[model samples]
Target: MTDSTSISLPADQRRREFIGGAKATFPLIVGAIPFGIIFGTLAEPSGLSAVGALAMSIIVFAGSSQFIVLGLLAAGAALPVIIATTFVVNLRHILYAANLVPKVRHLPQRWRILMAFGLTDETFAAVSSRYLQQEDIREAHWFYLGSFCAMYGNWVLCTAIGVALGEIFPDMTQWGLDFAMSVTFIGMVMPYLKNKPMWAAVIVAGAMAIATAALPHKLGLIIAALSGVAVGLSLQMLLTQTNTHSPAPDKEPQ
Candidate 1:
């Protein structure tokens, strides 16, 4: 059931491909709502204008970057500093785009760039997981759009509420809601503990995170994520090689 995503599609497939991509992305969009709500509620007191907050959700949709920008603004940082910090926090998108080039290469330049803007950890998870199933081009674009659109809408609406309620809302710290990010990470990681190699990756990454937790400006997160990616990829490659070289298991005698 592999398709052109695995390289080769029928001429008659038409725009059906787009539909698949859109459909696959929808659930992600739905799931993004709570995160967006938290961001809005937390950032409300940071002096984000409705238009400005809306624009942020529209343009710099990355959650981490948005949070950094809000944090900077909360600290009374300069505009240039906030913008630059946001850009730095989102630089990981460059790597995401590099790895994803092959998947969206066939799309128009405008669409490809727009699609790249939609890249996020959750979107990456969905796309990569789909590729594992069959690499069907049908799913990527549609699913991505569906998810992106939902998340985008959620952010905009939440930000609007936060901005509208700016003066009256209680302090965010009062809610102890800042741990949403930590909870989100745990949610993403716990499900991946399926086997030995995955466990190895998690352990290595967790150790690295603790070791580097003292680093400044959220650098520990980057270090830990990269360590996990590298170790996990290496282990997977090694296991693949070993399996390929080993003889097949023998059947029991009747």
Candidate 2:
């Protein structure tokens, strides 16, 4: 499946799709730069070496968890504690990655895994929408690569910027850039809120997150995400069954 997914796109089409997708999603990465910088700058204060700080961005390639890791390191948390927290902080990514796997299943395993790692909210939002709409796995792969490249580039570059000049900004909180993450999420989710099922999922997830806020180790986010996914899936399944079982209103009685 992996090889087949990538084989559909001709070489030239693949290149074109890659470039186009990259251009389309480039601005999103630009918007996310400040958040990356803020994370990097805070890394020094977290007591991690510059190498380790930068390495996390390159290898872990996740923004929120990297920041959390830095803080945990600064607090002198135990190694297991740090790993566990980072894993929890990143659990939402499983949702991102699982959704994308089918679209790129034709690619080879190595490519599939690499692409999976590159998956993030912004890139997945951009690439998956196009992939699902077109049903062109290779083009979707190209789009994913483009979106991922743009995001990956910005993250690496911005981390360097944050580390080198973060002190100049003084306070990331003061600049109001933190709102960008919230705004990014809104931009991604709002467009898909035209239906009741989706709206229900959003409401359920948010309510759960708020309700679980007091749970230890910031477990609320996990609960919220799980609740959101489960509610959405369960509701969808019930609706499917209801539709399948019920007679059509247009047909009426024979």
Q: Quick one: best TM-score, which candidate?
A: 2
Candidate 2 least-lDDT 10 residues: 131-140
Lowest summed lDDT over 10 consecutive residues: which window, candidate 1?
Answer: 8-17
Question: What's each prediction's clash count?
Answer: 9, 7
Q: Write the per-residue lDDT of candidate 1 for residues 1-254, one digit (tens) a residue.
A: 65656454443343444455556545555555555766676665676765677788877777778877778888999887777666656766666777778888888888787787777876676666666566566545665665556556666786666555544665544665556656655665676688777888888879998999887566776787688778988999999999999999999999
Q: List the residue pairs that clash in candidate 1.
A: 4-7, 20-139, 21-139, 21-142, 21-143, 22-142, 22-143, 25-143, 25-147
Q: Give Cα distance to truth, residue 22, candidate 2, Å.
A: 1.5
How high is each candidate's TM-score? 0.76, 0.88
Error of 2 at 88 (Å): 1.5
Stretches of candidate 2 above 4 Å error? Answer: 1-9, 250-254
Against the true structure, what is every candidate's RMSD?
A: 5.5, 4.5
TM-score between model 2 and native: 0.88
Candidate number with greatest lDDT: 2
User: Which residue pairs in candidate 2 have backbone atoms (N, alpha carbon, C) closer than 3 angstroms, thus clashing?
Assistant: 1-105, 1-106, 2-105, 2-106, 2-107, 3-106, 5-106
Looking at model 1, residue 213 earns an lDDT score of: 83
Off by over 4 Å in 1: 1-31, 42-44, 178-181, 190-192, 247-254
Candidate 2 structure quality by residue, lDDT tens digits, 1-254: 37865776588687888887788677677668778888877877778767877898899898888877887788899999988887887889888878866766678888888787887888878886787577546556777787888899899888888887766765664676777777777888887787667888899999999999888677899999989888888888888999999986795577
